[model samples]
Target: MAIYSSAVFPPSQLWDYAVKLYNNPEVSAACLRLQDRRGLDVNMLLFSVWVAASGRGRLTDAEMIAGIEAGARWQADVVAPLRHVRRYLKGDIAPADNRLAAELGRGISDSELFAEHMELQFLNEILTRPATGSFGAAERGEAAADNLAAYLGHVTRDISRDDLSDLLQIWQQAFPGADPRLTGLFGPSLQ
Candidate 1:
């Protein structure tokens, strides 16, 4: 894990914000859909949201790719396996006592949560100062959309416009009636 000598762009508050936003049932479902169907990184998705919310502008394509690479190993080896096990235990695919499965599920959930924290820490290592100068909500939204599109492009060469739109809509709805500064970044109406 990388250690920070000073406060990073996404301080603890923004991390907390990511956690809260991700925990929303709708947001969680959308994240899973993007992850399972589109091969998107949930952490990166949440990171983009954090960046937009914190007035950090948006990640460049290179930054998004680097961030994805930085966290790929831990995410694939630790988080994904834990998640697979937890989900497997939930289904009839695995035969185990209800009590034992439940206990193991809780442990797996904790491990996954810890792994996510580690991912966030890794991402913090590469954090840059928010973009200089003021930007309107629409501009920020466009930046975020572009960042997400770049990420999707990396995952699959043929990125679907509709999929991108759906993903953006999910993120926009995640935090409705947000702060005035952030409202425009989510969608046009909020702007």
Candidate 2:
């Protein structure tokens, strides 16, 4: 594993948004499920919400593609590999008395986080220019839903019912104060 220097990259709004959201247990589990089962990019998922929260109403298909492409190579080459190793270490491969494997797993986990931070930074560069349509707080929740659906639509047309549930969990966590009317909007609104 390699060490990553945080001094090289300052945190951005997207990073801050992601950290707070992912810290929620439900959100983190849902995100991991989407990543592991649905082949979704968690950073891209978080980016969509961040953009919406930032008041950018909805992302165009082209914009969604750009976000996906921005960190594709890095995610494939760096982040995924590090995650694979870190997960691989969570087994009985090591002798009972050995702490080396556990310590190595911790290092790999940190490196994975650093790689994700780098990927978020890359995605943030594309958002430097202001988007045309901006929404206020009331609309931001709907905007967040639209942005997530846009990003998910880019991945697959057939979003399963369970996927919507996970997405709803994520959306609710992202916008805890979203109107009750806006709550449970994923099924029909997202489609």
What TM-score would every model get versus the actual structure? 0.76, 0.87
Q: List ranges where model 1 is wrong by over 4 Å.
A: 1-11, 93-95, 130-133, 174-191
> All models: lDDT?
0.68, 0.81
Instruction: Score residue 175 of candidate 2 by CA lDDT.
Output: 84
Candidate 2 on 154-184: residue-level lDDT in tens?
7777888788878888988888877625633
Candidate 2 segments whose C-alpha is farther than 4 A from its true place: 1-5, 94-97, 131-134, 180-191
Cα deviation of 176, candidate 2, in Å: 1.5
Worst 10 residues of 2 by lDDT: 180-189
Give residue 52's lDDT in candidate 1 (0 to 100): 58
Q: Which digits, one per residue and each the tens of the lDDT, describe model 1 over residues 84-172?
A: 99887776644568878777777777767767777887776677685455866655565665566566667777655546555655556
Clashes of 1: 0
Could you give me the TM-score of model 1 versus the true structure?
A: 0.76
